[model samples]
Target chain A: NAGVTQTPKFRVLKTGQSMTLLCAQDMNHEYMYWYRQDPGMGLRLIHYSVGEGTTAKGEVPDGYNVSRLKKQNFLLGLESAAPSQTSVYFCASSSDSGKLLSYEQYFGPGTRLTVT
Target chain B: DQQVKQNSPSLSVQEGRISILNCDYTNSMFDYFLWYKKYPAEGPTFLISISSIKDKNEDGRFTVFLNKSAKHLSLHIVPSQPGDSAVYFCAASWGRSYKYIFGTGTRLKVLA
Candidate 1:
C-alpha cells in the first residue's frame, strides 16, 4: 500500500531559507505526526494532527509549523531554517480507533535535512 | 525533561544468544509502551509492545516485559541473529494520547 511516503528524501538548506516537507499515507490514518531525531536525542515530536484540518503543538514545536488540510497528507514547514535544525525528520501515521493495534505507527523512510 | 530513557547506547550479543534491551520511563501515567527497530537509512518499525495491564507480551522470537512498579520495560530477542542487528527505540504514551515520547535508541549488534 506504500504505507507512508515522504517527499524529498534529502535536502540541504541555508540559514534563513524556507522549505516544506510533504508526507502522504495510503492507510487512511486519522492521526499524523512530525518528529525530528538528533544524535543521542531520539525522536521528538514537533507537531501532530489528530485529524484532517486540525493541528497541535508537541514536545518541541519551535521553529516548525504544520498543516493537515487533507486526510491523507500532512505538511511540515520551516519558516527560517537554522543549523540546529539539521537532523533526520520522520513522518508517522496511525489510527485513533482506541484499539491496541491502532497505537502502532507506520513511518516513512525519513527525510534527512542539513541546514548550514 | 526526558520522559523515556535507554541507558545503553549500544549492545553486542553473540548469535544464538539472548539479547535484552532495557528502557525506563519517569512518568507513571504511561499506560502503553512500544519498541521500534531501525536499520541504517530506514525509519523505525514496530517490534513489540506491552500495556500496563499485562506484564509481558510475546510474539515469535521477540518478547516485551513490563514492570509497572519499577516503571521499566524491556525487549528480549531469543536466538539473536545478525539480521536482528539494528538501533532499537522505546516509546511511551499515556491514556489515549496520540503522542509518544521516545528514548535515545540503543544500537544492537548481533555478531554471527
Candidate 2:
C-alpha cells in the first residue's frame, strides 16, 4: 500500500499565487488531516475532516482551506500565498477519529513550499 | 500556548547503549499520548503510544512510560542502534477532540 502520498513534492510561489497540495491515502481511513511543520516547531494542524464532505478548522487554520471530497483524498488550498506560509506541509490519515481509538497518524512525504 | 514540549533539543548515545527521551504535556484533558520518529525531509512516523489508564506500554525494544501525576512521559530504547537516530516527537490528544498537539521534536543521535 502506498499508505499516504502527497503531490507536488516541492513548490515555489510568488506572493498572491494560489495552489493546492494534494494528499491521497489507500488505508481506508476515516479521518484525514493537514498540518504544516516549520523549523524548530512542532507540526501544527491546519484543518481536518472526520469523514468525506466534513471539514473543521484546527490550531493554525489561517490562510489555508481544505476539502475532503473523497475518503481517499484530501486537498489543502492556499488561496493567496504569503511568505509566512512557506513551510513543509504534511498530510495524515488514521483509522478512526482518534478520540476513541489510537490517534496514531500516518504521514505522507511532505510538500515544501516557498513563497518569495 | 504549547501544550506539548520536549525539553531536550538533542540527545546523543553510544551504539548498543540505552537511550532515554523525555516529553511533557501541560493539558490534563489529554488522555492519549503518542510518539513519532522522523528523518530528514520526511514526515513523522508513529512509533509507540500509551494511554492514560496505563503507565507503561512496551513493544519490542521500544517502551513508553507515562507518569500521569507528573504529566511526563519517556521513551526508552535499549541496545540502541545507529539506525534509531532520528528526530522524535511527542503528541497528545483528548477523548473528545480529534486534534493532536505535537511537541518540538527531540533529535536523537545513536553514535556508532
Candidate 3:
C-alpha cells in the first residue's frame, strides 16, 4: 500500500546549497514529522505538522523548514546546507494525537543527505 | 541534555537466547514509551510500546518493561533469531505532544 515514501533516496549538496525532501504517505495520517539521524545520536525531530496547513518547530529546527500544504504530503526544506546538517533524514506519520491510540509512527525508507 | 539514553551502544547474543536491551530517561513527565527496530539503510519501525499506567507489555517475541520510579525501560526479545539483528531505539513522550524523545539506539547482533 506504499505506507510512507520519501523521494530522492540520496543527495549531495555543497555548503550554502538548498534542497527539499518530499514525504508522501498513503495511510492518511494526521501527524507527520521530520527527523535527522547521526552517529551516536538518535533521531532528532526537525519539524512536524499536526495536519494540513499546520507546521511547528521540533527539538532541532535550526536549519530546516517544513510545510504540510496537503494532507498526504509533508515537505522538509534545507534553506542552506551545512556540514552539520549532513545526516540521514527520516519522515514519519501517525494516525492521531498521542492519546487513545499509541501513536505508532510509520517511517519511510529515509533520505541520505551529505553536505560538503 | 539528552532525555532518553540507551547505555549500550551494541550488544551481541547467540540465537535462541534472550536479549535484553536497556533504556533510561531523565524526564519524569514521560507517560508513553516505545521501541523501534531499524535495519541498515532503512527507517525505524515500531516494535512495541507501553504506557505509564502499565509496567509491562508483550507482543510475540518482544516485551517492553517500564519502571516509572527509576525512569528506566527495557526491551526483551525472547528466543532471539538472526533476523532480530538490527538497531533498536527507545522513545518516550508526554501527554499530547506529537514529538518523541529517542535514545541513541542499541545495535543488536544475534549470531546464529
Clashing pairs in 2: none
The per-residue C-alpha lDDT of model 1 at residue B108 equals 99
B10-106 per-residue lDDT for model 2 (tens digits): 9999999999999999999899999999999888899999889999999999999999999999999998999999999999998856679999999
Which candidate order results from sorting by TM-score in descending order? 1, 3, 2
lDDT of 2 by residue, A1-116 (tens): 99999999999999999999999999999889999999788899999999999999999999998999999999999999999999999999987543454567899989999999
lDDT top scorer: 1
Using alpha carbons, what is the TM-score of model 2?
0.97
For candidate 3, the lDDT comes to 0.94
Candidate 3 or 2, higher DockQ: 3
Per-residue lDDT over B1-112 for candidate 1, one digit per residue giving the tens place of the 0 to 100 score: 8889999999999999999999999999999999999999999999988889899999999999999999999999998999999999999998888989999999999999
Pick the winner on DockQ between candidates 1 and 3: 3
List ranges where model 2 is wrong by over 4 Å: A97-101
Considering every candidate listed, which one attains the maximal TM-score?
Answer: 1
- Two-chain DockQ for each candidate model: 0.67, 0.69, 0.73
Docking class of 3: medium
Q: After superposition, how far is residue A104 of candidate 2 from its true place, in Å?
A: 1.6
Residue B3's lDDT within candidate 2 is 91
What shift in Å separates residue A70 of candidate 1 from its native position after superposition?
0.6
